[model samples]
Target: MSLEIRIAAPEDAFAACTVLRRSITECCVADHKDDPAILGAWLGNKTPQTVASWFESPTNYSLVALKDGAVIGVSLLTGAGKLALCYLLPEARGLGAGKAMLAKVEETACNWGVKAVQLHSTATGEEFFASQGYVRSGHVRSPYGVDTIFFWKQLDRGAAPDTSQRKRFCNCNSA
Candidate 1:
């Protein structure tokens, strides 16, 4: 299926939150272990209000991927060069949405004078980030006490290949 990447709007907050909640709860069992406590803590800040605030921030570059006008993916790149959010619903995984959204974030980051971008990724997303040319900078303790990997990638003409997005669902369901 074809997907269109567009900037997120305030009204799109609920859709974004829905995508995030569904993807994390259903697909990220590896990281969360299906524990209510851990999941609650992890998703505590993922409410629609939170998404709306970020979407309305002129400084935060947030995007959503739509298929048949439905939001299937969400991504965010902060002015400080952090990839704050990136997730795709399960059915949308194999499509080119992830790579296309990531490219847009990187492009925006570079344009905003960010020389490098860093993101905290779960076990599920580690391999995906590596394939995208991000190197593991180190490890950090997640709020749930999991040791998540910190990834960093420099911006350049040849940072990541805009290769046709491959369909691989690993431990990382999303970033």
Candidate 2:
């Protein structure tokens, strides 16, 4: 199967949301521990409309990973260089889709001239993020009742776009 990663469109919200929910419910058992209260709160705002709004937000860059034209993974990066979300269908976890999406997120962060990228990783995702060069920074109890691991990666700003040449429209360092 071929995997493709691209900017997410509003129309992809449903499929992306599905992937997000499934990934959390199935793959994140270590984090939520099958606790209905934690899962419910964590997934409360993951609706299609919310996902569509995320795709449309000027401060966010959203991406979807497609496997043979089906959305199998989704990710979002903020202008401030936070990886707000990254999820993949359980069946798609071992594939390279997650890595591709992360590369794209880092590329976009560099384009925005971000110095670092941060994320709160679930228990299931800690090793994956660590393998991708993220350093564990701290730990926190999420509002949804899950214990989360914080990770950050300092980007190579040398490859970032020159701020002098482009109009600063985001809250990133370029601005």
Candidate 3:
């Protein structure tokens, strides 16, 4: 399968939203446990309009991974160094899309002078993040009632670690 990753455009919002919603609803079953309430709360803001807004935000960098011209994965990185979203369709897992998207995100962070990248990973995604060199920082109960793992990676070895406490922007509620 041919895969391509690029900056998301406003027109890509609907397709990106589909990937986000499907990835959360299907691939994240471990985190949501098929609970309708949890799913509803998690997916509440994953609409086309919201996705377009995210793409349009100046402080945010959104990306889409296409498999044969169809968007199959989506990711977002904030100016504050938060990896707010990194998700793939259930069918897109194990195809290097996540890793490729993550590499691009890290590259973007570096280009923007970001020293570290942080994210809250769902149970299903923890392993993938860990494999990509993210360190497990802590754990927290998400606003949507799921236990999430916080991970961070230092991009610059010379940069001091970020120690100040900041509010987390979980993948489930990044807006």
Candidate 4:
């Protein structure tokens, strides 16, 4: 089945949250404690109000993947590029939806002149992002109470200065 991709609107926040929450709970298991208390406080307890706040934030951007009129995946960008959240339903996995979502998020970041994009990734997703050009920054303990690897990618601006020039300039005596 084909999927339709679009920028998420305010009204779609709740549904988007559902997809995110589910994906995190199921797919992020290896990255977090399975204890109900921790899981509930972290992922299972997200409310529509929180999701709506994200949609209303000027610096945040969300994209949704729709198949058969249902939101199957979502990617949210925040901090003008400092952070990102992406999740996909199990049924939607391995269909290029994740890649497509990341592509759109990077495009959005480029439009906003963001220098890079970063995300805290689960062990499973670490490899996925690596395949998509993200490099592991380090591992961090999740604010929600778990540990995961962090990854980031510098966006290719297509017309930016080459690294050689920057390195040469950094050597002051090179003048």
Over the stretch 1-175, how does candidate 4's per-residue lDDT look in tens digits? 8788888888888888888788878887876657776687677446777877777788888888998888898888985585567889877899888999999898888888888898888786888999999989899977677777888888965767657645453666865
Model 4, global lDDT: 0.81
- Misplaced by over 4 Å in model 2 are 157-175
Scored against the true structure, residue 60 in model 3 reaches a CA lDDT of 98
Which pairs of residues have clashing backbones in candidate 4? none
lDDT of 2 by residue, 34-90 (tens): 999999999999999999999999999999999999999999999999999999999
139: Cα error in model 3, Å: 0.7
User: Between candidates 3 and 4, which one is better according to lDDT?
Assistant: 3
- Report the lDDT of model 3 for residue 78: 100
Off by over 4 Å in 3: 158-175
**Candidate 1 lDDT tens digits, 10-127:** 9999999999998888878898888898899888898999999999998899999999899999999998999989899988886989889999999999888788899999888888
What lDDT is obtained when candidate 3 is compared to the true structure? 0.94
Cα lDDT tens digits for candidate 3, 1-175 = 8899999999999999999999998889999999999999999999999999999999999999999999999999999999999999999999999999999999999999999999999999999999999999899888987899999999998776666786776868765
Q: Give me the displacement of residue 14 in model 1, in angstroms.
A: 0.7
C-alpha TM-score for every candidate? 0.87, 0.89, 0.89, 0.85
